[model samples]
Target: MHMEILPFTIAVPDAIIDDLHTRLTNTRWPEAELVDDWSQGAPLAYVQEVCEYWANGYDWRTRETALNRFDQFTTEIDGLDLHFIHQRSPHANATPLLLSHGWPGSIVEFHKVIEPLTDPTRFGGDAADAFHVVAPSLPGYGFSAKPTETGWGIDRIAGAFATLMSRLGYDKYVAQGGDWGAGITTALGALDPTHCQAIHVTLAMGARPKLDKELTPEMHHALERLQFYRDWDSGYSKQQATRPQTVGYGLVDSPSAQAAWIIEKFWAWTDNDGHPEDVLDRDEMLDNIMLYWINGNGASSARLYWESFGKGTRHVVTIPSGFAVFPKEISPPIREWVADSYTDIVRWQRYDKGGHFAAFEVPEVFVAEIRSMFRRYRPGF
Candidate 1:
């Protein structure tokens, strides 16, 4: 199959921006949440403030220029037009790395680490530690085409990503992801072990520890966090999995709704002190929100949950694997449990800070973790 890779740039029309402004101006807001905290979802005041700034203060051109600073391209893979950022390292022996973004995140999550990873010398690291980075917006997210049919589940998405790396002329590469991206990366390791040399994941699913046996302190904490997520943090997943279209109508039409939907996760999931802005910049948060808002991917992105979540057979990975356990991530698996599924566990590190969005929350730590894990397999440590 011939794949045509064409240079792509972010050029949202002025009319679209004008439309967004008008919609923001006319947003039909609801009464403020009865509670002061975020237990009831994003507060009315916070959402309105963010939306107002998005309309008048935020500059899309600046964000677009930042995105276009790197080389981006689009290609047809399995009947879907895939979009990716391909930045090659100056070092000839640089390893190829595929970085995948999860829900509520786009390629924007990797903006901070791309340069440091691709050109390590420029960031006070040796050129020998450089990597040829390929960060792709997952199917139905960002600029990638939404799946029109069923069956674009995690395994299928993993296969498509393998094909993408092969199409990019990389016969061997490492994969890294978190959230839904972690699920896809683990699937890649299982589906294409020969080509996918190793994988580093922040979220390790498919590793069910035996609860019947005595649990260690770490195991008990892991179970507690998992239970908490199942109880409170999984409402969005359930909604997306069952009725994405019903939710998409409001998200696609109202910018405020879209902002609240995504912003709430940033608050709940990230390691923040009272507000999301404590750990993440307000503009940076909005930059990510705009990716979903402009693409109108509210429904298409959510449909991924419906296709794969709780619907597929789990595959055990045999290839080398590394796990970075961030403190505040919703699902933090114990090393013993992760070893049950990922047979060849090479590296496992725990951090005191950072959360689910490690790339965005702690780029330096994230880069160091990636470099450290692959160094064992990259031929020269």
Candidate 2:
């Protein structure tokens, strides 16, 4: 397929900004019942402060230009226009690596990782370790075209990305992802195991179960953690999987609603414990929101959860995989359980800090781990 490069700048019409501003100015906030805590939700004062800034203070032009600084393009992959940033390393023979992002996330997650991954030498590493990063917005998320069909699951997307690599003239490349990204990356490695050298992911989420033998202390603890996640943290997934469009309507229409939907998860999932600013400032967080809003992907992003669930694709990923388990990810799998499906468990790291959005929450840790693990497996280009 002939690829169509994205315009240098995405045109955000004045009316849309005006609409956002008007909604912010005239928001009919919900009633508070003598609540001083966050149990009710994000504080009205705080939301107003953020909305006020997003309306009047935040500068989209600056972000827009910054976004365009990296090369962006869109290509048709499996009937969907897949959007991606193909940032080539200056090193002539940099190994190709595909990085996929998860829901409530965009390619914005890689902003800090780009320089480190593309030029490890600058950050005290050999030039041989640099990667030509190919970060793609999943179909129905961010700049990628919304999935018009219902079955755009992880396996389909993995196959699509396999074709995407081929489209980019990359016969072989490495793959990495976290959260939903991990699912897609696993699928990529499974679909085209020959083309993909190896796969790296953030915890396999409930992708492991071993009853054949006794569990080790660490594995037992990890299983307990997984149980906690499934019991307490799966409400959002259930809602998204069951009724994406219904939830999306509210998010797509109300910017505040969208912000709350995505922001709360980032806060809870990241090692932030409600204080999101610890890992990323409000501006940086809102910039990610802008990527979703500008691309009109709130609904489409939710569609991914629905798509994957219906197809039952995520449960079967046959790939040589590595997982970086962060403390805050919902469903974490232990090494033994992960080894049930993935034979090649070359490297595994457990991070005390960091969460679902590892690339953004802890770029230094994530990049270091990526470089450390892939170096062992990735052959010179």
* TM-scores for the candidates: 0.98, 0.92
lDDT of each: 0.90, 0.79
Give the total clashing residue pairs for model 1: 0
Each prediction's RMSD to truth: 1.3, 2.3
Candidate maximizing TM-score? 1
Record all residue pairs in model 1 with backbone atoms less than 3 Å apart, i.e. clashing: none
lDDT of 1 at 249: 99
Report the lDDT of model 2 for residue 155: 81
For lDDT, the strongest prediction is 1
